[model samples]
Target: MARPIWTGVLSFGLVSIPVGLYTATSAHTLRFHQLQRGTSDRIRNRRVNERTGEEVELDDIVKGFDAGDAYVLVEPDELDEIAPGRSKALEINGFVDLDAIDPIFFDRTYYLGPKSKDYAKVYALLERALAKSNRAGVATFVMRGREYLVALKSEEGILTLHTLHWADEIRDPREEVPDLPGSRVSAGAKEMRMAEQLIDTLAMDWDPEEFHDTYRDKVADLIKAKQAGETVEKAEPAAEATNVIDLTEALRASVERARAKGKQSKGKQSKGEQSKGEERKQRTGEQSRQGKGGKQGRTGRRQGRKESGLSELTKAELYERASAAGIPGRSGMKRDELIKALEQAGRQAA
Candidate 1:
C-alpha cells in the first residue's frame, strides 16, 4: 500500500512500459532527539553565515561548488539544465546475467509497478522474459536530482530495480585493509584442518527471528529504571582466557567447543526439524533456498577471517566494538587499550 515515489516510462528499443518506482526497504532503528540535560528543552540546529555569525534565511542560501581556492555559486535551475537523463525515462542500457553483477555494487532496491492498467501486459511480458532468461535489464535514470545505474530484474512476477554504485565509488580493499596488500602470515595444515572441523561442527540452520537486539532491549530497560527512580548497579566484568599461545591448541579447543555447542543445539530443535539444514529444503519454488548454505558458509568463513585478526582493525572500529560490548570507561581508553579490552570482551562472550 505504499505510494510510488516516481512515475516514469521504462524504455528498451521499441518496447515501453509506463511504470512507477516504490522503495522496497525501510529502517526500524529507534530515533532520538537532542535535549538539554535535566530538562525537556529540545536542541535545534541552525544554519548561520560563518562571517556574520547570523542565521541565514532559505531564500538567501545558494549552492556553491569548491573551485580550488574559491567557490562558484550556482542556481537551482542551472543544475536541471545539465542533468541530461531527468526526462522521465528509464532508458535500458542492455541486458546482462543477474549473477554477473557483484553484490557489493547494489545500493538500494525499489519495486517497479505498472503506472496504469493499460501497460500491465507489457510489464508482465518483460517480467516473464527476464525471469525465464535469468537476466537483468541494466539501465541509467535520474531520480531525486541524482543519476543512478540500476538493474531491473523479475522477482515473484514483479520487476525490482536495484540502484548500483558508480565505478569510482568502490575503494580498493588493499589500500584500506591491514595486512591484506602484503600479508606473510601462514598456517600449518593441522591448524587449518582443525579450523575447518570447527566450522563444519558449528554449521546450522539460521532463523533470523531467533536473533534480537540485546543492547537495544537493555537501553529500554535503563530508560524504564531511570523513570522509576531506581539506581542500577554496573554488571561485573567477565574473566577471559589469556594464557593460550599455540595455534593448534586454540583450533583444537575451538573445534571441541563447537561440537559441544552443536550437541546442545540438538535439544533445542523440534522433532519435525531437519538435520544440518534439511528444514529449509521445502521452501516455495518462487524463491530457491538451495544455495543459501553455500552463501552462509562463505559468510561465516569471511567473519572467521576477520575475527582472527583483531590487530588489523583500526582504532575507531575497535572503539565501536568496545562500545557495543558494553566496555565501561571506553571513552577514556587509548587505541591499544581498546583493542585489548575488545579481545577480552570477545573471549568472555565466546
Candidate 2:
C-alpha cells in the first residue's frame, strides 16, 4: 500500500482541510552497485569523524555552519521547533494567476488528497474553485526540517502542490552564461520564415506515451549481450553544428524533411484505420465459422507481414531492423542504406 509523505491541514482564510501529500512522480532508472576492480568485494561508504579519523554513528552528527572564526552547531530538534506552523499546517498566503509564475521556479510535484472521506467535499470545493478561478495558491511549509515555497493548483479534478525555488536561488543567466545570443543578434526574415515552416510541419500534440528512455533500454541490452557473449548495436552519431553561412539553406532543407515525415505518418495512420475497418467486417461475417475464421486470420496476418515494404517504414524502424539483422556499420547507415542492408539480409535468409 502507498503512504503519504506528510499529513497536514491546508489552511486559507478560516477554512482548514486535513490533507495528505503523496509523491506524484517516480524515476525508473537502473541502479548499479560499486565494486572493487580486482575483487568481488562491494564498495560501501561510511561516516567517519574528520578530527578523530574513526567511524561515527549518524545519531552523533549535528548540522554545523562554518563562521569566520568558529563553527555554530545545531540539533534536529531545534529545526523542528523553529519550523513554521509547527510543521503541521500549510498556510496559503494569497492566490495568483497560474501563468504569472515562471516555469523555472517550479520544482517537485505532490498530489494533495483528503486525509479522510469526511474532508472530501471541502477538498473538491477547493479544487473546483481554483480550476474556475485559473489561479494557484502560493504558500510555504516546512518539510524534512527545511522550508519549501509551494504553489497549490487544481489538476484533473484534484489538488496538486508544486514546490518552488526561492527567489534568490535562481541564478542570473546573463551573468553566468558566456557568448549568449541576446536581442542584438537577429536572423534574416527568409531564414525565420523557413524555420517557422519547419516547426509547423513537425508540430505534434504532446503524448508522453509515444516517447521512452531508449538509452536505458540500450544499457539493459548491453548487460544481456555481455552475459551471452554477444555484441550490442550502437546508435548513430549526432549531427554536426549548422554553419551560420548556410542557415537559410539548412532551414529550407529541414522544412522539406519535416513535411515528408508528416506525410509518411499520415499515410501510415490512414492505412491502420483501413486495416481496422477490414478486421471488423471480417469478424462480422465469420461469426458462424469461428474455427475456420481463426485459421484464416493467422494466415492473413502472416501474408500482411510478408507484403509490408521497407519504404513504408520510418528511418527509426529501419534502423531497428538493421540492428536485429546484425548488419555491419548499421549505426552509421543513412535511411536508404538501412533499407538496402535489411532487404539484402532478408533475401539471404530466404
**lDDT for each of the candidates?**
0.74, 0.80
**Local error of candidate 1 at 220, Å?**
2.1
Model 1 per-residue lDDT tens digits across residues 1-350: 88899888899889988889999987645578999999999999999999999999998898999999999999877776787556489989899999999999999999999998998999999999999999999999887678889999999999999999998999888787876634566767877788888888877677443344545545665777999998666667985664536667777878888878666555534321232122122222112322345775556434433444556877555565565456787755656677667555544543
Candidate 2 clashes between residue pairs 3 or more apart in a chain or in different chains: none
- Assess every candidate by TM-score: 0.70, 0.80
> Which residue pairs show collisions in model 1?
none
lDDT of 2: 0.80
lDDT (tens digit, per residue) of candidate 2 on 216-280: 76787688899999998788999999999988888888888888887886776566446544544
The candidate maximizing TM-score is 2
Residue-level lDDT for 181 in candidate 1:
30
Query: RMSD of model 2, in Å?
Result: 8.5
